[model samples]
Target chain A: MMTRRIIYLDNAATTFPKPEGVIRAVEECMRYRGGNPGRSSHSVSVAAAQTVYSARAAIASMCGAEPERVAFTLNATYALNLAIKGLVRPYSHVVISNIEHNSVLRPVSSLSSMKTDYSLFDVVGKAQGDTEGVLASLKSALRGNTGAVVVCHRSNTLPVEAPLEAIGELCRKKGLTFIVDASQSFGCVETDIEKCGISALCAPFHKGLYGPQGGGFAAFGKSVSDREIRTIMQGGSGSASSEVSMPGYLPERLEAGTVPTPAIAGALAGAEFVKRQGASRIDRYERELVEYMKKRLSRFDKVKVYFPERSCGGILLFNAEGFSGEELAAALDKRGICVRSGLHCSPLSHRVNNTLSCGAVRASVSAFNSYSDVDAFADSLSAVLSLR
Target chain B: MKKCYVSMSTMTLAQKARNILALNKIKANVVKLTVDQSYGGCSWGVETDCDDQEKIRRILDISDIPGYRFIRGKE
Candidate 1:
């Protein structure tokens, strides 16, 4: 008899087995519309430009933004770099959360030396003690020079949800730019840019969006003045070729050089698939599955589960007694269970949770996960914990 | 089978809701009655009249908690 294949639960890193439509879209783009977008006057080039614009429109609709305000980037990291480095000026103040991914943390940390004062607030416990606490913390951290407030919708480890609407209201009141990093929570959670008052939002296509690895996009809010947010890169934007400078527009101004048309096309398919399925239904299903897993894990005396009161998505972080996180992860891997065990790029969160040394085992679920998969994981975990 | 009602104050925010649902298994709906409003937390009411009372009681016993008031709904 043949053994079963490994069960994938590390979706927080990247989604696998691209949805059929996503693959088909990429293949179609490569085969037929292989011209440079916004480059030439030829029909193929125009078709390519139309495909890219359609993708931009889909992403914008999903995030509740206008099509023209959306611009594609290499990935969330690059988009974040462009947002932070381009927006904050010398002596400007910025507000951030302690649960941000390295994409936001590292970039902001690097900018610390430019005489820009930054206040990193802990969202664990502030006024209401739930995600609402994070919003209050962000509001309190704002100062007179507060040029922008950057926040991660969900944490890599804790999975604590951020109150984007409340924070957005405060930023609007203060006339400050509000940037959101939706890397882990974009597709799984609903984001209404208009309601949240978000000035800019950076998201990767690979994770919750279920797109190819290389493509990502940023949605710029209408309230954000063009002069307030500068472009980090300058070069070919498919237009304005006569002059060497970048175009004085929204997307083209930031999207310099050749666009990843194939990746964007694939992401468009993924976004469409997600839209068809409905993000709210997906969210509810994942929440129920996570609750089931949490219940099962709680039965064992040795298992230590870490879940926030309010979750952003389906990522679960935990460890068992008498066994290191790495040891358990390796043991599970031997049993054909895929999980991630490490700092997860947010060192500050690990240090705060005291899981920096061995780190915590992360089992993130996706829309593809089934009830049987959760059962298998729970049984495998029980067996692994009993080994010691 | 007699109904088993679990109080909200007895279990942790997540545990209280989950335990009642698992025990009832079928034909039961967990209701949030009154709860500690801190951190958006609240209480729930579970309907367990459709299942076996002894089985439900055993399951609830294993799922230990504090400050709970169990009630039997009219059968």
Candidate 2:
């Protein structure tokens, strides 16, 4: 009996069929160590806390962060919100990339409505071989009151990446905080906190780290002062109870309320998986798939691929002539190819790629995806194009 | 400065207490407890010098870590 595997190309949204040992760790945490971390010093509680700490350490080690400074959030959105709202004060100016995801835009927009001013730097220029042009755009966007600069490591709408290290250097020279939304690039790319001058690196454990959903982390660097990065949400931190005010610490300062222990447990195993597999190996495997997918699928006249120059992550953005992104994706779906169509919660990315009218189709692969899976996608795309 | 043990309900809180003490200039080491010292399979605690025990106790009180009772000591 042969059972066919569903060709999932939506790793950008979330990694499906999570890597091995992740499920077992989640189940084990819920069943065996069912105690509240930091609430007390009971054996079960301490054990649970150890598991969470180990996960944090694993994630931080990979991100080039100190374990104690990494704070767990409900998801990357929460982490991003914490970073954005925590940094921007009233009347502060900020700079952001033009092709940011909604996670970055929505929170920054909230600040805009309040009083903070912001300017968007052109990142599409970097993708078009204008590296110095991108740097100039970022420099031009900065103002005297610019307190922070936010950028996405890679665009979700395209396979293109922003000049993060350059932006980090700019932030350092300007003495402004640099925040990176690493949702689409963390596990597949290296984000050294110090080298990149990242004040806070926000990402979900699921997408690239191959961890569970509902778990996100933000690793804060030394650039974020305890006084500057204030708390947005405050409750029982389980660390400092004697004072009415929240405790002034790295993780405990940011984290308040009960954490998602089960998710953290799963993330522990997932981080272990990433560590064992190594980020470079995963990047190499995904790059191979992306290369194969691009070469095989682009020969069709109807297919117009964007960011084909990318050799980093496993993401392909394209449009089929005479067919809308939604329609093309639907046809692919019928062929057991799971892909994301439309804005992908990132309207600005479409605007940057000149896909404002009809959103582009995204087929993002994971390390687990093989060459055969990509071949299936290409074959299905060709068959669908011929039908049209 | 006699070395002693201060056990909390959870390793997370114990580690926190140790960090706080260090920040306040009180010396302490966080370590996994020996099997004989544990009723359960595994246990961890802060090892502080007796000279700083009162200081650590005062700091812990100020921390207000919930349900924080000294599980064991006097080893």
Candidate 3:
């Protein structure tokens, strides 16, 4: 007899079974518009460039920015690197949260040695109690030499939503650059670049955006001037090849070499899908599922759930004693339940929560997850607890 | 206060029952009935009167109590 698969609850890492149109768009790009975007005058090149432009427009609209201000990169990490390295000069100070992913941590760590000073505030403890703690930390950490304030819109582990507007206002008042890492909340939550006062935003096409994993982008808000951000990578921008150096422009200044046309096309389709479904609806659905899972997991005597009050995204962290996170995850995997068990690339967050050694099991949901999926997960967890 | 007693191997389940009681703000003592050697876990029975059964059920609803069942005492 064949047993049906129980459920999938790990969507924060990357969304699976992407929308049909997303796959279709990538296939179409590969088949029809397989040319270097912005590099040629042929019809194929124009078609590829148009596809990329369409994607940029969709992303810009999603974040409330001008389409020209958006530049494609390899992934959110790359976009963040460009923003971090390009915006901060030598002897500049930077502020970041402790709960940030390695994508932000590693780059900042390496850059700090090159005469850039940085301060990391522990936001995990405060995130559980107050959402504004992230912004308050950023404001307090600001110094005269502080050039940028980098933040993750939502912590990948706890699903805590940062106060982007307040942080943006603080950055504006202090004449500092506000760069946001929206890899977790880009498609799940509505982000208005103008309202949040964000000077720049870096996001991946995968994960919440529901696209392939190769494409990412950064959008520069109106508050930031073109001259302030230096271009780190200079190469063929496909337009100003006649010039000896990179053009002094918005996107072309940052974009180097041939872009990932297929991934960008897929991202456009994914963003369109999100637009049609509505970000608010997706946010509400995922939040309800997380709340339901938290409520159900709290019943187990051996299970310890960590759910903050103000979190509305998908991720949930918890642990069961007498069992490591890997052991609990393995038990659930036997029942066809999918979850991630680790520090989730944030060792600082785990240290703050005292889960460094065992690391809590993280079950993140997406809009595609159904209520029945949550119920099945709850049942499987119950079975595992019964064995304890 | 009425006292009920049962035997189980581990105190994890007992602690969970206590948490459920605290969440519901109910006052009662939960005693483990027996420990199953095969699973190395225990079976538990709630010892509240008919008046507190509904509140206990509400607690169970929110607590995610595992292997929960009502067992009426032999009168």
Candidate 4:
């Protein structure tokens, strides 16, 4: 740990300074409940299993899904890979969004090698909360062999949120499975699987949930059967050891190998914390911070903020003149400010925003962040830009 | 005071079955089934009072929690 005070604004990558309860839960889990869940009948093992179940139940409740339908993974990337690869049928086409993170884009790209084609619909040029443009683009991209549609619920680099309910409706109308990468929206945004008719909703607990990294999940809706998804990874699920094939169930079928107990415990506490704080409340506060940052950023003549007219969530993207994103980020880091630079693992988003050349610096906020933090960031950014 | 074993495919299903029974005012414990008790290899079962066997069966059947089989006469 550095002795200097640091202002962390990279909540999109992973939340910093986790909630007290989350830290306590993780420590307690490792100290007292270190048993492998679902593998034994001992008290310790049973307790561990209960902890896992509670985490799953918490996620399921948030997503309007059954507890059994929630399968925990290392992170959202694993969950997205599982959802995209398992749900999309062979020789079928899929439709994705133009502003998707590499998690969704890469899997869909690799699927092309398996003879699965995909189309990219433009999520740009649409105002916040508007889904008509997205729906029209999606409809035009659907093909005769289209089996699924995967889209990011919220762009990681910008404040853009895709109209999930609208996309879900379109997928339902066409009898297509809707796979959503909710990495940026989960925990902070309201996501209802059954109500939205989402076939699969994948999210990470570390982002808006205030959980530690290494824990995420994919919650399947009632519309898609477990059998519809083919298993990508297979191992002992601690349930059916006799059969060579994986168990025929929602979670066990997908969750192979032992899950990270400490991470799950921390995530459970984080989810509970989010629930107590109220997701809408957290969202509103973060958006307020973003708005403040945008206002302050406008004072600088050299700063160029993207999508200034649209309603952004917690993230704000901008670049200072006469400096690449990397240069700006490095200068900010020297001043004890943390912000992500470059494409943010989202070339597709950069491409859509026309910022792929030098990318943009992204500053995201979480509930732990305060207005003072925003002030410090703006002051630091201004001082850095003035030097150039 | 004897118990009946409701065999489940996975521990998750067993836990779900136990919760469903608990909501119906019935107490059940998730237990690991031995090789002799399990159908194929390792598995889990919900151990509940034998007197509520029929009630538990009906409750699980109507609920979404699916059980492999109900093994009775196991104290």
* Candidate closest to the true structure, highest DockQ: 4
Considering the two chains of model 3, state its CAPRI-style docking category.
incorrect
Q: Put down candidate 3 lDDT per residue, A10-118, tens digits, no spaces.
A: 8888887689999999999999999886555467865786687678778989999877678889999999998888887788888888778888888888886788988
TM-score leaderboard ranking: 4, 2, 1, 3
DockQ, in order, for the candidates?
0.01, 0.12, 0.00, 0.81
**CA lDDT of every candidate:** 0.76, 0.82, 0.77, 0.89
Candidate 4's docking class is high
In model 4 chain A, where is the ten-residue run with the lowest total lDDT?
Answer: A122-131
Best by lDDT: 4
Q: lDDT of candidate 1?
A: 0.76
In model 3, which residue pairs have backbone atoms overlapping below 3 Å? Answer: A299-B63, A299-B64
For candidate 2 chain A, the 10 contiguous residues with the lowest summed lDDT are A239-248
Candidate 1: regions farther than 4 A off: A1-4, A126-132, A308-311, B1-75
* Cα RMSD to the true fold for all candidates: 22.0, 6.1, 27.7, 1.2
- Candidate 1's displacement at residue A363, Å, is 0.5
In candidate 1, what are the lDDT values of residues B1-75, reduced to their tens digit? 665665432112123334355545644444434323211233334455635556655665665433345665555
lDDT of 2 by residue, A1-388 (tens): 9766589999999998797699999999999987887666568876788788778778888888867678999999999999999987778988888889989998998997768978898877844556799899988998888988999998777766777788888889889889999999988887899888889999998888888999899999877766568788998776445556666656776778889999999988988888788888898898788899889987998888887776657888899999999999999898899999898998988887789889989998987888899889999999999996
- Give the share of true interchain contacts found in each model: 0.00, 0.09, 0.00, 0.78
Clashes of 4: 0
Candidate topping TM-score? 4
